[model samples]
Target: MTDGPQGEATESPTRWKFSPVQLDESEILRRGLDAFAELGYAATTMRELARRLGVSHNFITVRYGSKLSFWRAVVDYALAGAERERNQLLAEHRDDVERLRGVVIQLYRMSANAAEMNRLIADESTRDSSRLDYLHQRFIKPFWDSIEPALNGLMAAGHIPRVPTHILYFAIIGPALALAQNPIADRLDPVATPTAAQDRNSTADALSGLVLHGLLPPSGSETST
Candidate 1:
């Protein structure tokens, strides 16, 4: 059976109902991400993906119909995983700031390790706004929305300076991308680059500091309601 996008079925229900075949979407995505990391999106082929999956080249065609389709499906799968992790993180934190920091750090750590798949998604995203939109809607946007209230609470408590939640999100993410892109991450000096754990703690401190002490021009200290 071929893997479709996250919401798409591995095989039609009719096919599964008649035949007792099983499919592994995560496994397929793992191999696809591996291939994309090593070969890049344009260079990676269905045959290579099949090779990684220990299946025949025809299997990929049979399952996904085309390379483009398979790649798109992989993107969905990756985003789905990110969304799952996000939900779990949010649940664990339960609308807490520290928990939100953990959530962002965990995602960054995952992306850092997912070199191939992350590369493919990044490249595709540059050319395809929809692909980026899919990622944002599934992972980034919800995460920001979920934490907005907490940020506002911090502001009211005088724990942080009042700022747009989106700005805070942008600040948090800037360092995350840095961690993912850091070359030291791939080497023995992984610690030289910020890991998820590192980002979690540092971001919390940075955000807290920013909240308590407004980082604005001396004249622009006025907080917007």
Candidate 2:
């Protein structure tokens, strides 16, 4: 607290005043993710979410206003860095097609870490709630808007068959996001450490390979990649 070596007058360390800026918001929301993932939206409470974060019971309501607002904040906080990262991944490639491929693989890689958010949206989507509308407007539609043009171009060029964007989206999203919903993939091939980076990448790459390449011989399609 004091740098006065002469000790003429100084605030001592023992008498130092301290104030935390605020409780860590991101940490609280992450635990919110876990709680919502396990308990679903109808069941999770702001108090429980705050408690799980080891903060005051009123923390969520005070900072975020309401349960729905807190959920939106959780989603925004969880995904804040993803778009930039995806753009960074896209920047690595020169070819348009290669960029698409890179982005797809990047998405699968993203899903590895984003399974909770993915699963959350998936759960909400089936219910047709205002929350689902928020997710669609804020997250889902933007993703399709970003990628659909490329997909259409690929289709026009005969790189991939003409297909619905939702179909293609779910073709990858379904299997990749199942990590948060089910254990069938794990049961088929168990992972020693579920949260390890290596394991996550391996799972993502495998899923991407299947979705991108498919089972049958591409004949000459490998050259496009």
Candidate 3:
């Protein structure tokens, strides 16, 4: 609808009027994350994102300034909880193994919940872009490095295998990370269907046991290397 006579927006002559607007901010960010992850940065547009969220075409651009900025916001919202938990584990667990295990479990839990973030990470990791740099510096590197001390200590004691931490990182996370592929997960285990809570708890418990078994020394094989 066009404005009044001179193509100017009509305004209230007397009292001001304002109404409430209902918006789901979390849903907006989740949709934004999925869009960017599914469609690469070059292809994702603010107008399209707005349409997906049922907002005004220019709303995202006006509010977020640019697409890159919006992408950063989405990444932050998705990874913030995991980052916070990583810091908490570091602060609370003083012992080497304790800290390592705590961080591993938290990472696994967060990773399971953050499949879109993982997909985005996988996409960005293929190229040398600023988004990749931001992800590595802001979230990914710190997480992988947090367990180095424990790894070293265990390695020195002939506990875990002497694999480099990077390889070890992929080794420990790869299996759990496979949960991101819901198709394979559903098809492979069709006989046992569990509630979301039951699935999450069972996944964590099973992965933790599998990882620790590969890392920790045998019951009687704990000797300093």
Candidate 4:
């Protein structure tokens, strides 16, 4: 079961067991993400990750077989988690336009916080052909495919204009890219780094308003947004 930010345990008939095997995998990924983020994918070594995690290099070798395999797994996990969140947000707010706006806003906020993850993607795309391919196929392609239909439904029901959903996606993500390029913590005291949730909703609200205004079709216009 999941715990909320306030430390409340979620209600569930089936409790999540803390399996040692699962914990090991989680530890490796967590450490790898940190290392890869601080030092781009090429500079991040499995041996260094093992050292950071206080584990033997053999531990990583046994789990993923190679450094490349470990990197692939990290990318896969990050993308998979993003997709899952997107799907859940859409399912929960399928009929509410405001809720959908909130979802997009939240997505932007999350993307901003995922600077290291984004850095890995951007840096690797230039050097690793397979990584670029994996990003498109595993992350971006599926994300747009899943969300586009929900957006289409809003148009069909007259809640919004027929503007391409991809445009909306770009508008939402553009700000995050800007923020990721120059992270807030880098300019502040390292100990004072802000939490990801702080200022997230406000930023999202502003972006949502901008998008909705631009995307809403003119009153008498028959064209889709």
Candidate 5:
């Protein structure tokens, strides 16, 4: 008999809840790039990216519009720093040989820092799709374009062995790519891994040695004197 007016119609308690914190745009883009690098374009979706960023899928969709655009944003974000570094190196090192060496060293350091991006590029290279084309045009071409002039100047000045720019590009980047893409490359090489403090310096030294030795003008060459 105690059903008087539905228990006096008690008011529900105000449930205090914290709003989801907004993540920084740069942080979102950085995490997106890392996810794309690890998962590749096709395998990674907005949902997965949002999950990686600890946001909702709508966040990515609303911010980036579509997956293609998101992928482009990720690539652009990842390459922006590289483009700046390349330009700075080119500006700082006017001498052809010195510039080329600086570029090679910079690239080696970049490759070490961006192994996941390199892996993503390696993955993209296997397929001839627009995504790959986008990356080539947007990311890879800018880098090659910046270095081509330096490489050409080196070849013209006889500071480096006269080889095709493409060949020279590979010569400078190939070893670093191999080391970055292959986790076991350090073990495969004769040299032991360096301490954490010397990791970058040691890599720069090894890559610089390889490049300098390979590009040094052969004996009796005009530039060798």
Candidate 6:
């Protein structure tokens, strides 16, 4: 009787809730872009993507309608993000040299971050395909359209030596893509530590320096002091 009067029962907290977690479309698209970049268009399947993303296959199919459409969306998303970042970088830097350095650095970082995208594009370049056409029209052309003018302006102002835009374009992008694609980048640089391979800012700075030095006007003094 004394124990009954002194004791009170405690209630347990509920273990389950009914709220459903919402899936972020942008995040899903980003993951899809990475997958397609790694696997390419022919190899990447909606079911596989869904498995990787931990969602139903129907979810992707319903949202994107088809694998090709989804792939287009992924490409568009990645390119659009790059364009936005480039625009912001241009707005922030006033000097042509500084602006060009910023652009090179940004492209270097992008190539490093999206190495798979570079690989995928490289693969696409060897053959003719609708996807390649789509990429050229939608992404590549627009990118060049925006960047070529700035590069031309630099040349016009005599900040950089005059050269064919296409040649200059390759000079700027080729090294960055090669570094991203090749495993020999660390070996090529005497001071490239293990950390440098993974360090985006370090890679960007080094690449920008090299590109800027190459683009600069030739000094009249041919002999080194």
By lDDT, the best candidate is 3
Q: Which structure among the candidates has the greatest TM-score?
A: 3
Candidates, ranked, TM-score: 3, 2, 5, 6, 4, 1
TM-score of predicted structure 6: 0.69
Q: What is the TM-score (0 to 1) of candidate 1? A: 0.56
TM-score of 2: 0.76
Better of 2 and 3 by lDDT: 3
Candidate 5 lDDT over residue span 110-171, tens digit each = 77677767677777877999988997887678878877877777667677667666777677
What lDDT is reached at residue 127 by model 4? 73
Model 5 is weakest, by summed lDDT over 10 consecutive residues, at 12-21
User: What local lDDT does model 3 show for residue 54?
Assistant: 74
lDDT score, residue 22, model 5?
A: 63
For residues 5-33, what per-residue lDDT tens digits would candidate 2 score against the true structure? 78656775323321221346577678888
TM-score of each: 0.56, 0.76, 0.78, 0.62, 0.74, 0.69
**For residues 75-194, what per-residue lDDT tens digits would candidate 3 score against the true structure?**
988887676778877999888888877887777776667778867877787799999999988887887788888888878766777876678877776765664566666767777663
Whole-model Cα lDDT per candidate?
0.61, 0.70, 0.74, 0.65, 0.71, 0.70
lDDT score of residue 198 within candidate 5: 46
Which 10-residue window of candidate 4 scores lowest in summed lDDT? 13-22
lDDT: worst 10-residue window of model 6: 12-21
Model 6: residues >4 Å from true position, as ranges? Answer: 1-23, 55-59, 93-95, 154-163, 182-197, 218-225
Q: How many angstroms is residue 158 displaced in model 6 relative to the true structure, after the best TM-score fit?
A: 5.8
Quantify how close model 5 is to the true structure by its C-alpha RMSD in Å. Answer: 7.7
Residue 181 C-alpha lDDT in model 2: 44
